[model samples]
Target: MKKTPLFAALLGLFGSVVVPIYAQTVSLQPLWESDTTLRTPESVLYYPAQKALYVACINGRPTAENKGSFIAKVGLDGKVIKLRFTENLNSTKGMGILGDKLYVTEMAQVAEISLSTGKVVNRYSIPEAKFLNDIAIDTRKNIIYVTDMGSNRVWSLTNGKAELVVEGAPLQNPNGLLFDNNQVLIGNGDGSLLAVDPATKNVKTLGKVTGGIDGITALGRQAYMVSEWGGKVWHVRADGTTELKLDTTAEKINSADIDYNSDAKVLYVPTFNHNTVKALSLK
Candidate 1:
């Protein structure tokens, strides 16, 4: 039997990969917009104390001639505040906050920055990783979990050393990661949300999402996910119920992150494709 060219390419990407066996449907909506100034936004982190959302922009492709990545802070009213430039970040994706430290993951390393200066504090390297994308921190356990897109595996890090915690899994192009309570939620590029047990490497299908899942953030009992192709942000309950909280197909929202300001009742969404940020009011 002759293998299709596309199938062959996918096989090279996933190492003896099988095409998607099943797919689930998704519905989405748009909550707000930055209207201007954002280039290839990848993730969003809401800072309630300052009532701002930080947007991480992927300035160039991994192999593109330009070698720069940036982070921008936007107010709820759609005001763009360009934060310090993250000088050498490569193929950047997820962003997480721990106290005053901001952690950003790019390709094979995690870059730690000072929130005040946006200066690179330290760069943590992950060995044996093919393509590292999103990262989730479990403050309760003092551990961090990162997903590898090239290997379809999840790694665990503590005090900076990384070890393969989950291997030979069904994750397809895993991108965003969120650790809440005792579970780790992974968003895959194929449009699926998976619930994983870090201690066991056991996985359960939570729900099917549309578009390519990029970044996810958990607030309260609900987990919010951003889709790169669906161009929307979705809110899903831990129990697997989903709702289209915001739609930005028109704005070209590709890759997104969320920062929830509970007191202010606002949600910050950074659209990568549009190079702008969208602030959504929860009220």
Candidate 2:
């Protein structure tokens, strides 16, 4: 049978449609896991510029007196460059880097540490904040946002003053937060990922998970990777549906406050109680 022009055209059309749909399907491939030196690690931030990772370690309970918290600097190959790169903090959790400063969430205050010296330079506190869980910064406006899981509120800091952004009902003890452009992504305690407009304060449900969402990383347009503290990683698609990609709950390995390097398509997850960080390649 000779290949007809019409059949060839139809085949090319079908191939184009199928390839993109197949390419959209993504999964996690385990790359490497760090040593147990990361005690109670809660968050991992992949710094592309430096080609390294920052792991926030809450050595013990996230309480006011738990001053054993520290941040570890890890190489991209899952090696601990410095086990205690920065030490003597109170229950540090999430972290964000802007310029030469690293901002971290303490139990009740946001600690600003100088990246150059690895020393606490400033503290941003909200008198009523009980538990400050995550930090997200807007580089353009130089504003920092934080989530208070205990008080179920969201806040922003500018010019060294803290102000309420939103709280209560829809908040649901918001845990994970990501500041992406005009909208803020909040991972609620109720397992729903809400996208809130920063200007109008309107919110929209993007997706949901089985448990409280702890970490969120965007993978291009309308695609996201979210994690539950119970050790589940889910991929949220453009249609508001979710697929569980990884589950370590049975193994008791947490996936807390994960970060991704877009250029490398690698996700860096900090395992809280397991005391380690794992890297997974997005395939």
Candidate 3:
């Protein structure tokens, strides 16, 4: 593959590291925001089964409600409703829903909440993990993969028991993850995309990004990555070349995830700093 000029610019931008490039699109806007006092919204997920979107937020300081950090549900039409908080869930980050259960990871624990009631159903304490940043689930194996940002490791969990899958490796600041086919795709905050082997548990650098990436979501043959500090979103092809997909220079976009409603061909994205969701109609 030919080296992209953007690749060289990214390395220079971050001083020997890949820097995430922010998405630039004039049409991006706010879809929803919390009515609560929370300021820093971190991660978001869509629960197709429940027809709701789950948003996790942190106050950034030790507060009562945040000490028990919370997740809220917003309707597809932008109505926000506060949900129940899971006990001991501080600094809650990325969220994912598999089957009928909603899963969220905090500092070192992965908690499963009921889909119907929005109540905490179970909590799995990962002793070896220090900062569980994000999670990806393998429905076929009934296992959840988690990123330990503090320890620089990725772990796999089955039936609430955690096991080391990759330990003390070079996946520095690994944050966002997705499972594609049999491969695990991880987005490192330092601006690199990684493809990991589930069987051998090996990882390879797929490509480099220019800004600090915070979230990622795969859509068909493409992937959308969010630049937390760079204030953008990018469309990455399977071949590793990337382009600007969305930009929030006007809105200050942060973390993001994309879900394509196939029938409608509309892409839904939940953004962090701006505290809203957006949809791009691909007609």
Candidate 4:
């Protein structure tokens, strides 16, 4: 890996230390910013299957009864392939894919869209949900774990039935979720990165950040990148240490839900209020 002078010293210590030392002093260089067409883009998903990116656009308010939301397909190099790959959505936020289905959060429900056709094929509603935000999928059993930030809860959907995973204090405003290494990684409203064991439901704090978490994705087994809704992106390590990688709060640009193209080494960020997705390359 190429490293700057600062990172070279950091990685040098990794050879002697027993604990893994990842690239903590990671730098972000602006690569490209999409045109102001993605209104209130909430989440960005890098779909390796199609070699494209899927962006969930919350065109209007993030509330029910607003079915004007849609999904946009973007090229890997930051070009608009098809603006409206899927439409007629309701306050779309987070998205995850299972096989040929693209499951997206629609406030109080989850809409399943066909990846090939870009047509919504199934709608799973959670009547008891308040604000269903981000989603993560456990591919082993095909379970969909979604977070309800408004109600401070997490739910798992399988075989067309929804079941509560965890709720309340430990999950303060659970927002972003990721399924990695047999664990459901949650980005909490209270700025905590937690890992939950599905069988035991044991919650363990892996790290903590400054503000509420909105996006959680693993860079690798030992490192992750999490973003705050208020425009701060953090690089969190397995040892529970965090470092600020980006902040646009002063500019009032929000990083809602982020996706990283590992092959390109670029982080795709959805600036909610700014109406653009900025790709920042990891250098």
State each model's C-alpha RMSD to the native.
13.5, 3.1, 9.3, 4.6
> Residue 246 in model 2: shift from native, Å?
0.5
Stretches of model 3 off by over 4 angstroms after superposition:
1-39, 62-66, 82-88, 222-229, 249-252, 256-263, 266-270, 280-283
Model 4: CA > 4 A from native: 1-19
For 89-140, candidate 4 gives per-residue lDDT tens digits of 9999999999999999998999999999999999998758999999999988
Count of clashes in candidate 1:
11
Q: Score residue 58 of candidate 2 by CA lDDT.
A: 97
Model 1 accuracy (lDDT, Cα) = 0.70
Q: How many residue pairs clash in each candidate?
A: 11, 0, 12, 0
Q: Write the per-residue lDDT of candidate 1 for residues 9-72, one digit (tens) a residue.
A: 9888988864232222333334667755566777777766666676777775643233477777
Q: Residue 163 of model 4: what lDDT?
A: 93
Cα error of candidate 3 at position 262, Å: 4.3
Query: lDDT (0-100) at residue 88 of candidate 4?
Result: 88
lDDT digits (tens) for residues 46-82 of candidate 3 = 6666666677765464232457577777666656765
Query: What Cα-based lDDT does every candidate model obtain?
Result: 0.70, 0.89, 0.67, 0.91
TM-score, every prediction: 0.79, 0.93, 0.78, 0.92
Q: Which lDDT tens digits does candidate 2 get at residues 199-283? A: 7888899989999999988886767899999999999887788889999999998999999989989988888999989999998
Model 2: what TM-score? 0.93
How far residue 213's Cα lies from its native spot in candidate 4, in Å, is 0.4
